[model samples]
Target: MSASVRAVIFDVGETLLDDSTFWGSWADWLGVPRHTLAVLVGVVTTQGRDNAEALRLIKPGFDLVAERAARERAGHGESITDADLYPDARPTLGALRDAGFWVGIAGNQTERAGLLLRALELPVDAIATSDEWNVAKPDSRFFERLCTWSGHRADQIVYVGDHRDNDIIAAHSAGLHTAHIRRGPWGYQNADDPKLRATATWRINELTELPALLISSDTG
Candidate 1:
C-alpha cells in the first residue's frame, strides 16, 4: 500500500459494475431494439456526449421512473443484481481492506444503489451516493463529502473510476490521487482524450491491477 494513502474511494457504474445489460434492459422497455440503442449510445459516447443528451436524442422527455415502472409491470427491471459486478471488483476490494486501507464507495448514484451494494457484501468501510449527499460528482461538495466520509486528508486518498470528467479530473482537482480504469463506453471514449488521460495518476485496464500499483507506490 502507498504510505501516503490512507483511504481509497471508488465510483460506481462502470467502475465496479458492468451496466451494459442494465441499459439494454432499459432499451427493451422503451420499445427500442437493443442493437439500435447500443449504436446510439456508442455514437454519443464516442462524441463525448452526456447520457442525458444521448437519451434526449434517442427519446425526448424520457422519464426514468415511468419507464422503470413500465418495465417492472412487464417483468424486465428485476434482472440486474450483484451479478453485474466486474469479476475483479470483489478481490481487489478485499485485498485493499485486508492490507489495512480504508476502502469506500462514493459516486453519483441513486439512494437505492447504496442499498444494492450493501446487499452484495463487498468489503467496504463506507459507502455514499449523490442521492444521499444531495450533490453529484465533478462538484466540489461531492468530493468534500467523500473526504469527510473517508475521514482522510484529500492527498491521502485515491479515487478510482471509469469516467474521465466525473472521476479523474474532478478528483484530481480536489487533490486526491486518481486512477482511470479503461472499460465501458465512457472509459473507452475518455481513454483517447489526452487531457483526460493526463489527469490520471494511474491508468489501468482492470481493477485487479490496483493493489499492486499501491504496493509499488509504497516502495517508490
Candidate 2:
C-alpha cells in the first residue's frame, strides 16, 4: 500500500493456514507419538536445523511417500481442507482483494496445494508452490518466479509469512517488503532472533492486522 506495493503474496503454511492440527494428525497417522514428534520438531527448529533433517535423524528410514500412502490407505491422508485455514484468513484475503490489491499464495508446498485452495474457494488471484515452480523459498529463483507470476516488480510485492529464515529474511533479501506474523512453530521459535526480527518490514500479531497496516501505509 506504499503506492508501490501492487501485490501481497503470502506463505501458505502458518501464514494463511494453521498447520498444527494437520501435523498432529500426520504424526498420529505415522504411528509416532505426538509428544515425540513435537520434541523432535522443537529441538531441530530451536537449533535452526531443517525439519526434514530432524525427521531423518529420528526415523532413520523415514519415507514421506510411503507414509503418505499409508495414511491415505487409513483414509485420512487427503490434502488440507478449509478447516485448516485460520479464522482470520478468509476475511483478510477477501478484504484485500476487495481493496483492489493482487493477492497470491506462494510457498513451499506440494503441487496439489493449488487444487486444495481452489476447492476451499479462497479469494486469491494466483497460487504457486515449490513443487509447481521446482524451486522453494530462500532461493532467489523462487522469488523471481513469484515476481513474474504476480506481474509486479520485487519491491511492488509484500511477502507475509511466519518463518524467519524462509519468509522474512529470504523475501527481504529478494527485495520484497516482508511482514512477519507471530504464530506457528517457526514464528515462536524464531521470535528471539534479533537479526530475523530486524529484517522484517512489519511485524504483525495476526492476519487481521494486515488490512489496516496496508491502509495506514497508503494514507500515511
Candidate 3:
C-alpha cells in the first residue's frame, strides 16, 4: 500500500485541530442550552449523516448550531480565524512533502481550516473544500473530484480525516486508501463500528506519525 501511494488528503476540522472549545464557546455565547448543545455535538461529530431525517430527531440542535454560527459572526463581526493546529502538524506536513506525498485537504470544513493551513506555510497540492462542493465526504463525486484534480488513480492516493462515515467512506467508495485520525469525541463516536474501520487502510493520532505511516510499511 505504501509503495502504491503518491498522495495523501486530509480532513481539516476536528481531525486536525481541537475545535470543541471554540465551538462550545460559540454555542454558549449564542444562548444554546447545554442539553440541546450535546445533541448538536452528536449531529456535527457524526456529521448529520442522516441530515434532514436526523433533523426530525435533532431539529433544535441543528438549527441551534446554524443559529450559533450566525450569532457568533454577528456578535464578533467575523467567524473564527487562525486556529491552532495540534503540535507537530507543521513538521509532519513538511516531512510528507519532503517524502514526495502530494498533501492536501479532502473533507468538509469551516473557514478557519484555511487559516490553519496558511499558518503552516508549506506547499500542499490542494485543499478541496466540501463546502464548495456543496456535498460533504462519503459522496463519491467529492472523492472523484479529488482524484481528478490530483491526476492520480483512486488507489494512488490516501484520504485522511476525522469522520469514519464521510471522509473514509467517500475515499473507499472512490477506491482510495483511508487514514482514520482517531482522536477526540469525533473518533469515539464511530470507532467501535467495524464497518467504519473497514474503510480505513490506516489509522493514526499525531500528524507527525503520518509520514512514516505513509512511507513505511516495512515497520516490524
lDDT of 2: 0.84
Q: What's the best-to-worst order under TM-score?
A: 2, 1, 3
lDDT tens digits, residues 121-150, model 1? 889998888988899989988998888889
CA lDDT of each prediction against the hidden true structure? 0.84, 0.84, 0.67
The 10 consecutive residues of candidate 2 with the worst lDDT sum are 211-220
The best candidate by lDDT is 1
Off by over 4 Å in 1: 65-80, 218-220
- The runs of at least 3 residues in candidate 3 whose Cα sits more than 4 Å from the true structure, single-residue gaps closed, are 32-69, 72-83, 110-123, 218-220
* Candidate 2 C-alpha error for residue 75, in Å: 4.2
Question: Which tens-of-lDDT digit does each residue in 36-97 have in candidate 3?
Answer: 65566677556645433333353444574475467656774223343556665557667888
- Per-residue error at 143 for model 1, in Å? 0.3
Candidate 2 regions exceeding 4 Å error are 69-75, 218-220
- Report clash pairs, candidate 2: none
- The whole-model C-alpha lDDT of candidate 3 against the native structure comes to 0.67
lDDT of 2 by residue, 5-121 (tens): 778899988889987776687677667887888788888888889876656665679887777677778888657787899999999999888888999998998776767877887
